[model samples]
Target: MATTNVREITIALRSDGEGLLNSLVDELSRLAQEAVNFMKRTAPKWRSTLTNSIRADKISDFEWDIGPGVEYAPAVEEGRAPGKGLPRWEDPAAADIVQWLATKVFAGRRRARRTSMKAVHENLELRDRYQGLAWHVRHHGIKAHPFAAPTLDMMERSFPARLELAARRYLATTGSGGAA
Candidate 1:
């Protein structure tokens, strides 16, 4: 199994007092929430599971780990290269793919078929769809549809502004309305 690590972004504050630190912490939390919301909107959704899995883990006073929570999250975010092989399901008939197959592809107008109760073999379209997907995944591999890394990129670009804003808030609260 290949791996995809979440992109890292850091915000550091070395304040001697709690007031400035509080401002920085609040700003980090806001940035983390923005990142999560951006990902939930931009990520490729699989019944909203992938999007809902996004969270922010507070790593320190000023840093956070923001990304998805699911196992196949990296795969969904980064996409699988060709020849990654099909999913190793013991029984394709009762595989988790039934619900996935039931979900409509977001980019299209196709109606979702009700395939939850039926076994793969019992439904011709379901069986064919699963097998076709399996074959394609095994051969062609999944194309990369990245969102997490790009989100970090976007946030990093605006980091200077965010940091300045935090500093300004701190200064305002302390009545030191000078340069950050």
Candidate 2:
């Protein structure tokens, strides 16, 4: 659902000349790769989760996908309302500690002797200690920290000159006389 809301940037070039197409494709691919690098560098450093999930794949000789794969990537990019996103454990080790305390220390007490394992698991106090921290974070959602948009902005500022330069180099190297 989050991915459906993802913003995409498409760069296209139309050339009528026959031999210029291959040069354009190569230049576009290079530009896409450069943009992907820019996005990855600009991505937030929190847990590096979003950054690590970023990918850039050439859909065709002309297109690329440059974004994160994680489901929450868009949520992080776009922000979310309080209580809207999935809860993420702040400390998995702490949850294990809480489970141990519930099953070992508390379960050994006389009053807890009559309690079933299911009842112990369902104990509100134990559940709260284990899950409450995560819930609290999700209840107040994180603010958006956009990476893709800024990367696109940077690319837009420089891509024309970069493309033109690449085209010039390609033509000069290939000794092509046609218009690019």
Candidate 3:
């Protein structure tokens, strides 16, 4: 699932200070992963719906496609007289699953679109920050925010303060001030 683009993006995110930028990236990542996990969990129901919606004709050996609304055919009794001993029709769970998945699909698509928009806004903000940083550095060499003593101290302290210290170590190294 991991791609070269992921590495590139991580590298790009790290090439800056101001920890908030990294925090935005991390939030987006979490939303993307959660949407994917939700879809994966519902995938089996989708498959079952597709499979159960088909019908096979024995005489012509031709299969016919049917919608989920089709009810299961009842079994024919042989020479014995039918006395209503037949089992009750089994309730098809496919309809419920399909409906749930449809809802999920809509919700997932909406979430993805929202996430995309948020990322676009985040990118614009980062672009603005980079531009500002460049302007500051050009005007005043070895700027105040990049190597600020308090900021660096806070970045160093971030590790022991958080449970997932190792995973977050990359934040400080990336110049993300442990924020990203």
Taken over the whole model, the C-alpha lDDT of each candidate is: 0.71, 0.65, 0.38
Q: lDDT for model 2, on a 0 to 1 scale?
A: 0.65
Candidate 1 residue lDDT tens string, 86-124: 654447643667557645322354444567544433356
State the lDDT of candidate 3 residue by residue for 55-142, as single tens digits: 3222321212211223321110011232322211133633442344345434544333435886666446544544454354445543
lDDT of 1: 0.71
lDDT by residue for model 2 (62-180), tens: 67887888876676678767765343334564554355446654665554433677566556666565465446546886578888889889888998887777666665565442223
CA RMSD, predictions in order: 10.8, 12.7, 31.7
Q: How many backbone clashes does candidate 1 have?
A: 1
- lDDT of model 3 at residue 71? 39
Worst 10-residue lDDT window, candidate 3: 73-82
**Which residue pairs in model 2 clash with each other?**
none
Higher TM-score: candidate 2 or 3? 2
The pairs that clash in candidate 1 are: 82-141
